[model samples]
Target: MDTSSIVILDFGSQYTQLIARRIREQNVFSVVLPCTAKIDEIQAQNPLAIILSGGPCSVYDADAPPADPEVLNLGLPVLGICYGLQFITHHLGGKVSPAPRREYGHAEVELIDRANPLFSEIPANIHVWMSHGDEALELPPGFHLTAKTANAVAGIANPERRIWAVQFHPEVHHTKQGSALLRNFLFSIVGAKPDWTPGHFIQSTVTAIRKKVGSGHAICALSGGVDSSVAAVLVNQAIGGQLTCVFVNNGVLRRDEFQKVQRNMRDNLGLNLVAVDASERFLAKLAGVTDPETKRKIIGNEFIAVFDDEAHRIAKQTGGVDWLVQGTLYPDVIESSSVKGPSQTIKSHHNVGGLPETMKLKLIEPLRDLFKDEVRRIGRDLHMPDDILQRQPFPGPGLAVRILGEVTPERVALLQEADDIVVAEIKAAGLYQQIWQSFAVLLPVKSVGVMGDQRTYAYTCAIRAVHSEDGMTADWVPLPYEVLKTISSRIVNEVRGINRVVYDITSKPPGTIEWE
Candidate 1:
């Protein structure tokens, strides 16, 4: 289906994925490419319009990133945001300078031209979220300022060339009519139609997978989480009996997760699932690895090794296995493959940075373009059970990352017990679905406490619960004090190792959902 889509040039903005999500919500398809993407790559998507994402860089920097000069001359409608706005201005004969005062929070924007299509139905005075250190001090040739704040230009437009730019982030929830603004740009200006949906995605993906892996067997790393589960099932739908799913038990899974997931895959989903107990092997390799990155690399390499061994065995039994399917989401791709964006590598995802160069099988990532919620929608459309669809987001590296220090049996057991209690309590409080990701991280530090009137030193556990639309950005869940009290009390009393419990109050900007 030749769908009308938008091409989002990623400048490593934290909100770049949010912009794509907003466009998809309008039932229009969108894809994100790196800022350094060649002009041909941008044109290959046949985008109806191009959107330049906001980033954490100033256009006037010594090594400032710039889009392809050819993109400006493509004659396609371009919308620049934040750093993107500055880039468009500075590159096209306009002046950009550092703001005297950086705007970092909510600010009111007044529409100077009420007739502008981008601000079609928007009110005169509206609030927007701003995060920038530089501003487009002067408009480019043929550009008119359409909106302004008290101290800076909020928006500029060149109606003749169909170029638009905004200083504030319209994709974030802090903006009242952000979606409306995007809709105006997508529909009113670019003439795009809302035609994308989960059902359409499922049908198209099935066909694509079938065409990609024809007559060849494929192996999927099934963690039984929503992302992997959906990927496994979708591929199974495409090539039945040709897909062998390897579920590796890395000694860091939640309590009874392996057994339950095994049963579900075998009976519920009817996948060709193989459960590999490589826990001891993984633990032995990670014996004294204290560094988080090292632990991740060990786990990642071990996972691939196990998968390779299993694949060889399967190939011996069958003919051969040529592909490895993963449930890698867009955030993982964006964070891992950030080429020109200022977005820093927060943490290495196992499925991403952990893969070995020597691995023989090619990767098939169906959900690479989708977010967490979008994957859930596709799972629902496939009639997956609520339990599978609502499973909490688990890292591919498993509990190895959850345990702050060394990945060992003792630490894994302690973290698993504490994590199990956290989940059980959250489910008991009827807040499981309301929260995005809730897990327990076993801190490396130990504290002294009196247990049964005897002084003892034991591990301390940190509980993290966050509210997020997608895992791209999150805020700590403002759990009720009573809920917090219950969780803390339960973890300390029920879990044997932990002496104390602490809750993470940091948001995604300063902290990630996972401690590692």
Candidate 2:
């Protein structure tokens, strides 16, 4: 279970986690450490290799972040990326100059030494993703410039000392042969072993949970999403029947999702369950809330109020509980960090900010350090039913975000009906397992349409479906025309007030998963 091959020091790079993903894809275990990680902590990990991630700030900035110098002195193999490369060059007495013409994307790299360790297996000429304003102007002593692009030095290597740096990102897929290049650096140069798996993580988390919540009861908020369900089952394994699950049917949930999730939990995991029907309360609070932020705030605060009241009452009925378990994952941490440079705060996670500050319960986050795929594996290990394990991630605010305008009971019902039809059709077509996320959105705008020779002004429902690995970056899934036709037909026929159903083909840069 102690499989540590590569240690990636995050320098506020947006693609820092992607480097770890690539390493894991090669079956080599890797861990991400903050750039500010202590020298002792780095040494404690005993990494076979190190990769310095790219950052956003200039090296001359007063508070510009840099990796601890001791990380380089560890006498282990190292690879530096983008800002990481510049930092390495500047740290080792090389020169970094601000480029008058900054390189942003798609630079061709010409390899100077085909025999170099980093380029050993990779081709001599390749394309790399470039996004830096500063370029290395000079190489340090004993270091040889091993690659060049049209603009400046693209790569540097000191074979005598196992050090290498690249101005372009080898982590992103835009860089051709990136995996092969990283594999050469990890396996051929650093000699790393591939040994990380979900079973190991499950055992580690179970041990941690047992130690943290010994003889104490815990309550988990079951949103019927993969993350929460997996976290619930894992925590359930640790504390057995002491864990009480609260499934809140906020009015914003997908059509009949409450009943479906209830069945899943009972027939699947068989844990202590309390189904709270608080839809009317949520709908009442959400009425007339047009702004997205206000809707989120209102829904989040209301959800906690209902759940907290239920938990307090449950405690009085049964016994006292100590921990409020959550399914907080790793991406939530990285996306929330103030240190991630130039990264846009996509949306505030409700479960993260929903809890009241004065709540006295301790937290048991079993999936705190995990990713989506890792959560799925833990679900599989816990023998959770496939229905729960394969369910797409649903926001804690549910369909509240999917509705573009005010959260009304009528709109919520319409959206739920449309969403259920889409989900059921996808499941029937055997395409549910292939898509990462699929949902219905109730756009605020109403359009003119004619049904049975009667002109009517009705809401336009947009269907969003995308295929992604981790929900970070995604492309719209090219659903078959037949499947789309079926979903559209069902939505228009079954869901009242929806005159039209349109598929959203826009990707993440222009549109988010949720309509709001």
Task: Provide the overall lDDT of each model, using Cα atoms, as 2-decimal numbers.
Answer: 0.87, 0.83
Listed in order, each prediction's TM-score against the native is 0.88, 0.89
Between which residue pairs do clashes occur in model 2? none
* Candidate 2 residue lDDT tens string, 1-516: 244658888888889989978887777777788888888777677688889999998776788885577777788988999988888788888888898779998989999888887887677899889999998988888888889988888889887678998889999999987888898898789987766677777787788888888887888888888888888888887778888999998888887778888988877678788999999998989888899888888888888898888888888876787889888987766655536656556676687445765667888877766777777877888888888888877777788999998888888888888888888888898988899998888898899988789997899999889988887678998999999999998877777799998989999877777766
Which stretches in model 1 have alpha-carbon errors above 4 Å? 1-3, 57-61, 97-104, 132-138, 286-294, 337-347, 352-359, 403-411, 441-462, 468-475, 488-516
Judging by TM-score against the true structure, name the best candidate. Answer: 2
Which tens-of-lDDT digit does each residue in 365-454 have in candidate 1? 999988888999999998888899998788878898888878889889888888888898899999999998999999989999887898
In model 1, state the lDDT of residue 113.
88
Worst 10 residues of 2 by lDDT: 335-344
